[model samples]
Target chain A: MTVSPTRIPEATVARLPVYLRALNSLLDSDVRSCSSEELATAAGVNSAKLRKDLSHLGSYGTRGVGYDVEYLRYQISREIGLTQDWPVVIVGIGNLGHALANYSGFSSRGFRTVALLDADDSRTGELVAGLKIRSFDELTAIVHEHGVAIGVIATPAAAAQAVADQMVSAGIRSILNFAPMVLSVPDGVDVRMVDLSSELQILAYHEQRKSTLQPDDGVVA
Target chain B: MTVSPTRIPEATVARLPVYLRALNSLLDSDVRSCSSEELATAAGVNSAKLRKDLSHLGSYGTRGVGYDVEYLRYQISREIGLTQDWPVVIVGIGNLGHALANYSGFSSRGFRTVALLDADDSRTGELVAGLKIRSFDELTAIVHEHGVAIGVIATPAAAAQAVADQMVSAGIRSILNFAPMVLSVPDGVDVRMVDLSSELQILAYHEQRKSTLQPDDGVVA
Candidate 1:
């Protein structure tokens, strides 16, 4: 059965990589198959939602036997485009950018960091994770050289939009922005933000709720 | 109007910070008021969804004036518990930890980095963003001294779970994990993960779709 990639909802698409990670962990543990309940637990989602997400990829595990771990992993990997190596360029060799450049998870999965570019001339020759920090002027050359489609922006918020504009003009369409700003990109481009402050704020919201519900717990500071 | 925080759904709770950031940007730009559509555009969400989300906080703007930027900002901030400073401890002083420690967005928004703790003895006394890196054993003292409730784990994947255990023992209840592994915490403790690689994977999924739909675009490498 063929599942159209366009038909998968955004939410389901977001969850596929998570499911793939869970499946990979299972494979590492020498597990061959697992039930929806087990896979869902590994993915930190409920079984019903997990089943629904998998169904979107035309992957319905056998009723009693559960899913074939390797097979499902391949399906999700293909669906998420992880089967092909995605050449990625990291702009801005700041602390966050340095961390991202050193992050082994990307290469361990399917992302290949082809180049690290920075606007500051002083940082141009700096080596981060074995890759020399190139000049921002070299973005177009690097993108075309590596056939890069994805760009990671770890520059400060002030520089985020400008870096994004460069990435767009260089023919990159997918962006993972770590800057604490809202990036305005064209319709065809997809920008996903991973804001540290925003995540902390969300945690604070839940933390506040816990205190409100148990006022006498005396956990408040 | 008093809105009960408990009633807001998890999905809506996650988006409140984004809305708050958008409102802050508007406020910074001297925008006095904005309709649902304008705020939604700033937040990168549709107007209906933005309206529904704001309604959960009882923030229905005037019929014509839309939302008062300052007032709605305060409401969302208070709702997300950003009204008061949250004392946070960051465990790990690696590249990612350094970036997080230097992240100005957190302090600007309401979270104060009270202490930076790491298990590496050599790292102790090193200054990051003006805060001296302390030994991991100081976790308890720092948490109690600062009345800290949120802990951030930027340690390597191998050390994440152990750090989480120490944080839990030190009475920290909320965690924002940046490690590339799954963390298992007991009930009453909240954990949110920020996976950089996973975000790229999701982008690759959509990028793959675009290529599939427009094969003649010659975007594929």
Candidate 2:
């Protein structure tokens, strides 16, 4: 379904890769097809919401047979632009950056870390995940050479904004930020912040509620 | 105003931490008070949505007076149960786990990593972020001693499920998963998966749209 990407809601777009992951897992287990309920369960969402999200891509499973796992996976992947390789530039070769560079999941899902850039001159020539750490000054050249549109910032909070500004200047429009602080990018530049602490805080909130409910049982703090 | 923990919607609960962070930033800047618009902008959310989310906690800012930065920060923190320290245990001490253990955000937000566990005996006793790496076998004792309800799993995909299962047996009810795989947790257990690849894929989807809109340029690959 050659659907225009703009038509899909932002929330639905965020869930597309999740559904794609679920489909891949099903395929890995030799499952060629799955009902909405099964797919939803695997994706950790409800069937109704899953069906609604899939509908955004103009994909509606057959009534009795459910969704074709391979077909749906292809559609979602195509929608998410995973059909083509995306060259990526990652800034900040710190611990978090090192972890992201070594993460195998990126390459498995069409994202190729073309270069790792750091301001620390001493770490510039270091090899990470088979890519040599380069100076941040080479960002523009790398972006142009690879026609890269995606940038990942795994830098410290203090340097996040400068890194983002540099990325925008280099013509990169989409960013995945691991820094704790918020980044202000120019219009048309998309920034997604993955706060590691924020995720734990959310879980802590729920855990606190559990303790609140069982106040008498101090054993579970 | 006092509110039931269950009354806040999951979406609002998830956003509470963002509001807390924005308020903390405001406090850091010496800002005593802020209008809903200011807070919302700092949090990267619409004012109306921000107001609505805060209303769930029974907090309605004064008309024209706005919200007290410190007061609202405390309110949001209390709502998210960040008022008290949360003992947390992180399993798997690989690259990603090491990064997570070294992250300062968790401690700043009331989460204290009391223990770091790894299955590899060779890694035991190694110091990471000032905490000594311990064996996974010590999970039960650590959970009991620290009253730890929140667990972090940074193990590889293959070992994530096993780590999660062990966490559940050790009385952990909340999990922040960094593994690129789905986990099967029983009811009452909450698992939040932070898939780094999925975040990039979401950005790639938007980046692809930007390119599609100007196919003639062909400059953005």
Candidate 3:
């Protein structure tokens, strides 16, 4: 009943991975507990910012006392919902998709790639990650059978919308879209897009600014 | 010479894009100006939060008059360093690479994909965006010629580091990596990665938890 201030900032939620990595490092070194200052240094963030971020997830620290490393790790993991297994489907078994299928982190954590879907007939029933690559036609059944409420679209941009529409139609409400287009999803269906090119382009804009401003930042053409 | 507050909070800086999109909608509707409340409503954010965010940039708002839509748009654009043009290179032309190649937004928004590269000789010399796809062998020459400082990697996880190492070797200091692996770059190099499946898995973790947690707030799957 006293959990009135459990509203963590979205920005803080994004930084949880950085904090987790820092905590993992501390754990590896057998450090039992850490103050915000020590954790922030390991995570490349400031102590004040680290403390403020952690404060949003309830007061985990005692006054003048550091946090219990294992306790904090477990808390953060639970906060991030990594305690339970999540059935995930990665559509489009192309090069990028293949790379994603081979990614060790997904299964190592609670996130499991239950199926790999592709539209091409040649790819169908082929082995990837020991699971047969299935056609998009099996999307609905696969998702339903696996209870996969989350889908990853690593398809070509042209195929992304159709894949998304299919995913939504198949009762999947959560999407990680890799296609570089704006997806118009219905209400309650959450779509989080990861655009490889756009991120690069934004970095390029800043890098260009950095180069132009410095004049000497570039190699002569 | 007096200028607008030059230092905006990093948190506020990220939100400017969301606000910019909101203002763009207003512009499309022929709306001239908007109060912080109006803009926040359109952007699906809180008015007080929006106001505080903009305040970090400067007093772009008139006390009672609110903010001029177009003027504020321009101001924020300038503040984000989007007023200038940036040339970018896409390394490793795969499924994700093709999407980046055709994405119209990149060129439209002060960011241009100057060239697309691949390591495979067979894939090289092929045409995608009118410009012939070139081999990675020509990387140093191209980066020099285009004054390119921003690089995007659409390669497999194995080739990503090599691509990054090549980009750095060619004098590129900023990277947008789409590969699902972590890359270690030298100092002064800015690396931003967009992992497609990771974001969805994260969402799925929350989405799964949302089903268990009644009346869930913002844990999007």
Best first by DockQ, ranked: 1, 2, 3
- List per-prediction Cα lDDT, in the order shown: 0.90, 0.89, 0.75
* Residue B62 shift from truth in candidate 2, angstroms: 1.3
lDDT of 1 by residue, A45-117 (tens): 9999999889888889998999999999998898888889899999988899989999999999889999999
Q: Which RMSD values do the candidates have, in order? A: 3.1, 3.4, 5.9
Q: What is the lDDT of residue A62 in candidate 3?
A: 71
Arranged by TM-score with the best first, the candidates are 1, 2, 3
For each candidate, give its TM-score against the true structure. Answer: 0.95, 0.95, 0.71
Error in Å for residue B196 of model 2:
0.8
| Winner by TM-score between candidate 3 and candidate 1 | 1
The list of candidate 1 runs beyond 4 A from truth reads A1-5, A215-221, B1-5, B215-221
* Runs of candidate 2 exceeding 4 Å displacement: A1-6, A214-221, B1-5, B214-221
Model 1 lDDT per residue over B61-171, tens place: 999889999999989899889988899999988999999999999899889999999899898999999999999998999999999989999999989999999999989
- Give the lowest summed-lDDT range of ten residues in model 2 chain B: B212-221
List clashing residue pairs in candidate 3.
B203-B221
Instruction: Tell me how candidate 3 scores on lDDT.
Output: 0.75
For residues A67-177, what per-residue lDDT tens digits would candidate 3 score against the true structure? 888888887778777777788899988766876787665776678889999999788989887889998899999998999978888887778888999999999988887
